[model samples]
Target chain A: MATVAAKAGEAGIVGAAERLGVPLLTYAAADLAQVAVPNPSAAPLAAVGTPSVAEAAALLGAPGGELVVQKRKSAMATVAVARRRPRGRLALVGLGPGARDLMTPRAVAELRRASVVVGLDQYVDQVRDLLAPGTRVLESGLGAEEERARSAVAQARAGHAVALIGSGDAGVYAMASPALAEAGDDIDVVGVPGVTAALAAAALLGAPLGHDHVSISLSDLHTPWDVIERRVRAAAESDLVVTFYNPRSRGRDWQLPKALSILAGHRAPATPVGVVHAASRPDERAEVTTLAALDVTTVDMVTVVTVGNTASREIAGRMVTPRGYRWQS
Target chain B: MATVAAKAGEAGIVGAAERLGVPLLTYAAADLAQVAVPNPSAAPLAAVGTPSVAEAAALLGAPGGELVVQKRKSAMATVAVARRRPRGRLALVGLGPGARDLMTPRAVAELRRASVVVGLDQYVDQVRDLLAPGTRVLESGLGAEEERARSAVAQARAGHAVALIGSGDAGVYAMASPALAEAGDDIDVVGVPGVTAALAAAALLGAPLGHDHVSISLSDLHTPWDVIERRVRAAAESDLVVTFYNPRSRGRDWQLPKALSILAGHRAPATPVGVVHAASRPDERAEVTTLAALDVTTVDMVTVVTVGNTASREIAGRMVTPRGYRWQS
Candidate 1:
């Protein structure tokens, strides 16, 4: 039980805490005055130098908690109750690769369950119809990933059920990482995995990822070029099938060619490479070509380039990598 | 237009091919007899030394194609048409982490659209209710992945829409690699990516995969232990986060420990390691422990073990790896 310093000595308030077998928490007028409450009145401010005694006291008593009941006035005193630990839910939802059908059922359900939805402007537009009528949408432009993560975490901290949506699997080069970095254990976090771009592109290219693989993002916006080069070299040396995400863009033109050249040092010129652009979307295009024959100009930001390992082959007009080294027909 | 050798010289058959502006390809009785036909008649066999002239001729005319029309007999003749390229769709669908909601809408829709669904008996049972009425299900016991893949391809070759289901993303250490190796360009293949076990486990354990990561299956059933070791060592040297799938089973016990030891060589002993069992399922369990403290006995085949990179940290009981190398709080 909680009460103001002056009310802590009252017989009725003391008896209620004793009967409930809980210690009475008393707050000073200065401490209560610092707390923000929904209901603030002149009566408490004039009498005890606080805008609200009951509401502020309730809030102050439950640290990092939320007010459950508003202030109610009685003949002798005012009362309010606060939940000691109010946990808000933050669901990081992945919408899959472009196509609506590719989105998982759980992702759609999370969108409806959330009272607040946050995502990039384009991703939010994709599932705008899925949200409930009263759900608040917090959307920003493409480069505002950190801002979106902050806003989602802040909303969740304020005790609102929030869903942060991203394209592809949230864990794979998407919003889940940034959002998780900003989020603490104060709120409940649920991760809804979606179909990542690499897998989506692999599907179109006749299972080029049938064997062990590694996914590397070519965009060096956050990561250094040397680190990216080292990872690509490691993948090449290991002979693991490589899936290159963010392979190329108008501004980032040289990375894809440079990365492919590293693989070429270890791989044969005839090595199979599958290039997929905008997989599963209406403008989706998938093509299988040899590493030497590939034209880098056709690649773009949305493209995913999968370079097959040494054992990978192009058979019957489709790229295929056998599951084992000693592959038998 | 196709016809039997005996009927090709006939004025009516020749005129019909001319009117249709197509070449009349005539097959001998022996050639026609070699081709299999669904509707075989004794009358055609006795008259031309072949089972059925129209049906066999149609099938032979379109190589690697399907018979769309059965033989229709009239008083004087029989007519049948074979689709030159009867494209049959083979959708390889990933069911996702043993949860109904984790399965994508496209996976469910493909199950309903398929006239034939082939998968392991257990995976087939997971979505048996989602299949449309009259859908033929060809399910086999475990260790029969090859047989299931063959059966699905055969069904698709015979001009039936087929769906092959697997748990988690089909491309990642699942049925897609084997199935695509067996498939040819004869069928239209569709890859439906699902929530891989690694991503699902990562989601439950916070954002351990906030950076570049690699998924390596520890089971040495098809892959050599040395090859797997090399990949693990490469991942460790590159400072990439690693997710171990097929970590352990009753028969295979040492692989998980060995893989972790490789990562421990490069990562700190206090690095966060997330162990998740049956993620997104009712029996889901997630734990974040340091490398030195993790108990390997608690892991099994259904479990996914993720080892964080050098930059990863445990904050408020959740494992998180910042998105950038030089992360500022």
Candidate 2:
């Protein structure tokens, strides 16, 4: 809220408050000046007769409220969060597809803001330098996602700012599920989206995802093989471009080949298939091949395989799918 | 290549060049010193007899060549690009779902690197301040996607660094399709992936994309309604979460309702649905509702509707779908 309703409306303050389901409370210059804030400014005092609008207003509203978050400014507006007590913060941050620059600014900010970071060992190693000095990092080995989620929630419940990190979007086959499961309304949870492996591989292989597509992880560790195969068959029959995550490992090479065969049943053998390893990483590699010629032995846990739809094509060494429907002129 | 092969290998330069299928050329210090560069340093001259390693090596490798990109230094290395002739450069950048902080660092760098920026007028307005001081912007109104693509490609062909911007991941129903269609081998193209609408909406609504999911655009302006309906049906039957883009507009209000009905056939009426309007924007609004309670009239072109699968649930007012085949023990 602003001194004038028009200012609040034009500045989008009113709409933002409404979206957050919070009331828009405004105070007059004389009234705001009466509340003394820890952080006071001469500029605001001259303009609105108050050194701090956000802190003052929050304190006025919450009787004994404390500043949980100091004033942070963006290009458009200023934000300061206050609460009557210390609230735990949980940030599910996606580090993007292995590349440092691919990570969003919000994800980096969340990592810096957190007092504790919980993640897989490898993912934590990737962004250890990005963390703010003195951040407590709790890293675990692979296949312990649930444990890490529990630990993160526990840390947050202890009144710490916690960031649970994952490669790619944490919501997509990452840490978000277990973390959200362990969390309740007691903590403030924030999800910071990252570039998923499928999207990252698609960029390297060109625009294979230009049309409707589906991403299905090929790992059978959690999902039953029958269920996974059913999805593969459905994608093939539906003519949807398919991106397979956790395509293969030393002990599980057969799943990828089997999935490929299921897809081959519906798609032509000449269909364009993209195999990407460690996309955007130091050892990043990508190739566009056909289902019949791709070597399943070459794939590993770090790889992602994208099978194009019947309408997809490899043009100029890049896979592309037109956006229009097949019959569209 | 470096002064020594070990250095290049240790820095991952050799692997990166090999992955891109480019030759890694090397030059001795004396040979590199023969080439004159715009920026020279005394430190390099004292150590390697060359004032500039990157600029000198690039110039020495391509005889009679000129520097296209000047020497830029990071903490680990220096980079300089030289070509026999001026080569056109094109970067298809995804601006990510709406918030300025949500955009990737790579996407931001591409925008700053480009001499020309081509995008929709509204998207351009969102990032106007982020553009480099002298960037030449070519913004168009609605329904001119093809024109914008052509202009971006043309600018790249004219030997200018061009960035084509779009909301969300540019490859997913955005500018990547048309732009890639217009591009040829003549220009060097780079894709900087952004946070797509589906991912952005998913973040706001919790982990609905925790497992296999599909995104289908509901707009029939170019795609046939029959084709759109088929995808929706496939997602419904496959038990895949469905994210609908261009869900509704004033003119096309029936499609979302029709699509929802099709999804309702496979999922229960109590299935969770997430509706996010202008996600990450100032007017952002998100709600979790049941399929039966969702009002299609409340949706608009700027909205994204995510219909959760049979296993999805609204826990503590947040929509979440487990990744496991069944409920965890």
What is the C-alpha local distance difference test score of candidate 1? 0.87
Worst 10 residues of 1 chain A by lDDT: A320-329
Candidate 2 pairs with clashing backbones: none
The TM-scores of all predictions, comma-separated, are 0.84, 0.75
Pairing residues by index, what is the TM-score of model 2?
A: 0.75
Off by over 4 Å in 2: A1-85, A326-329, B1-84, B327-329
* Interface C-alpha RMSD, model 2: 1.6
Candidate 1 ranges beyond 4 A from true positions: A1-57, A60-78, A81-86, A326-329, B1-88, B326-329
Q: What would the per-residue lDDT of candidate 2 be over residues A51-79, giving only the tens digit for each residue?
A: 77766766666554576776666887666
Q: For model 1, which pairs clash?
A: none
Positional deviation of residue A279's Cα in model 2 after best superposition, in angstroms? 0.9
Weakest lDDT window of 10 consecutive positions for candidate 1 chain B = B320-329
List the RMSD of every prediction in angstroms. Answer: 5.0, 15.2
* Reference contacts preserved by each model: 0.68, 0.61
